[model samples]
Target: MENLSTIERILAAKQSLPGALLPILHDIQDALGYIPPDAVPSIARALNLSRAEVHGVITYYHYFRQTPPGRHVVRVCRAEACQSVGCEALATHVQSALACEFHATSADGDLTLEAVYCLGHCAVGPNIQIDETTLHARMTPEKFDRLLAELRSKP
Candidate 1:
């Protein structure tokens, strides 16, 4: 399958280096949107690790997803600081707006919503990051709508 070849190519390129697991996983996810579940065995074998170890690493990192992801991802911080500043309220607004739950993608495949522990913007809590690239802090329902509109505008 295509996925197998991709895994092989990545392994060929990165398996020789020390600490290769994370980088290999990242590359696979970057290329394929998510780490395919079947990738575990190949990855484990290449790195001479147990499947449990590979799977553990994947599950331990919230950033590594095991399923196919939506076209866009929205991560809302739920850290203590963010919560103290109404991240819950913002999360509620995001859920309502997207009609999607955390750890799930929108019905139309428009976006995936997830709760992240932190984005390191404690000074401006209630931060939300779009597609892991854009960080918006001090979020309000109104701001969320605007951002959603901006996302919809993109191809």
Candidate 2:
């Protein structure tokens, strides 16, 4: 899979849909781990869209990653529900402990920290999503550290 480029993956996924710019992009990201710079041209040609149009979509969505992500991604919910529960303080603690700001990966490459609008856990408040798994309710700084440690130890 390492030898397979983003263009190849995008072309392969393009066959499945008639007008699949979004889906193709999703699959390309899923396969390549991130949308490479080279993919813009290939995707544009395949979808008959301008290069600028393709780039615009990619840049517009925060979910799209231009660069490769770390092994683990940690997303903190920053919606009003979470904010009322002191999520800002927790976010600061997490950033300080990891030594990285929001939307950035740690220097060790163990984690990528991102801010999310909501996690649908408003009642619990101060929610976090680790990778594909969501953790709800009362997120403390210490608990976050334990979760980070657990993710770091994974293969």
Candidate 3:
């Protein structure tokens, strides 16, 4: 976990939109790798929402993480289109290669795997987004492994 003071800095941003919980959550997650439990009260106070309301919002979003993430987050598309193109097998191969289950991080703490509903690249099918960049069309297991190796090589 990052220092709680970091979260306090984020809360001070006052970035939430009226009646829009998602943007606030996104900003928080973007600033901090994950949402800290202590943020619930702070967010509630800032947004003029109840603690339960803030907590509910956090729990409702699958994009939110309660724990720190690995240095890189790998999201594999698992929507119907991606699955139709063999994403399941690709996902299984990635899990096996990394020795980490979905939503789990590698032992080296370099990668975290997650399943995403879609990347809006169905035409490419079986797309993957590594961190903020989307890799379109070519998400074969072999390619994924190579990409991982490339990411590992970086300092």
Candidate 4:
């Protein structure tokens, strides 16, 4: 299958590195968009790690997704700093607007919502990182709607 071949290629490419598990996993996710459950066994075998070990690593990191992401990813800060600035309400608004919870892709597959501890913009708490860039500061329900509208309008 395509997934198997991609996983094999990733394993071969990164197996030679020191502390290769993390890099391999990251590469796998990067290449496939998500680390499919089936890839776990292959990864474990290539690295001589147990399935449990591989699964543990995947689940341990909030960034590693087992399912593919949507066209866009929205990460709302959940750290104490963001919380103090009303991130809780912001998060609720995001989930309600997207109709998806943290780590879930929207039904239309246009967006994925996730909860991140911080985006390094704590001073501007309630910030969100859209995709890999485009950090929105001082987020509120109204601003979030505009952002979502822009994302939806994108190709």
Please write out the lDDT profile of model 3 over residues 1-155, one tens digit for every residue. 46456656666665455665677677778888888788788778877889999888788888899888999999999999999999999999999988999989999999999999989999888899988775757689988888989999999
- CA-lDDT, candidates in order: 0.93, 0.84, 0.83, 0.91
**Colliding pairs, model 3:** none
Location of the lowest summed lDDT over 10 successive residues in candidate 3 = 11-20
lDDT of 4 at 27: 87
Candidate whose TM-score is highest: 4
Instruction: Provide TM-scores for the models.
Output: 0.91, 0.89, 0.88, 0.92
The TM-score measured for candidate 4 stands at 0.92
Tens-place lDDT digits, model 2, residues 53-150 = 99999999999999988888889998899999999999999999889999999999888999999989899878999877757578999888888777
Instruction: Please give the lDDT score at residue 84 for candidate 2.
Output: 97
Better of 3 and 4 by TM-score: 4
Model 3 residue runs over 4 Å out of place are: 1-6
- Clash totals for all candidate models: 0, 0, 0, 0
| Model 1 clashing residue pairs (backbone) | none
Instruction: Judging by TM-score, tell me the better candidate of 1 and 3.
Output: 1
Candidate 4 per-residue C-alpha lDDT over 79-107 given as tens digits, one digit per residue, 9 for 90 to 100: 99999999999899999999988888999
Candidate 4 local accuracy as lDDT?
0.91
Q: After superposition, how far is residue 63 of candidate 3 from its true place, in Å?
A: 0.8
Query: Model 2 residue 34 lDDT?
Result: 81
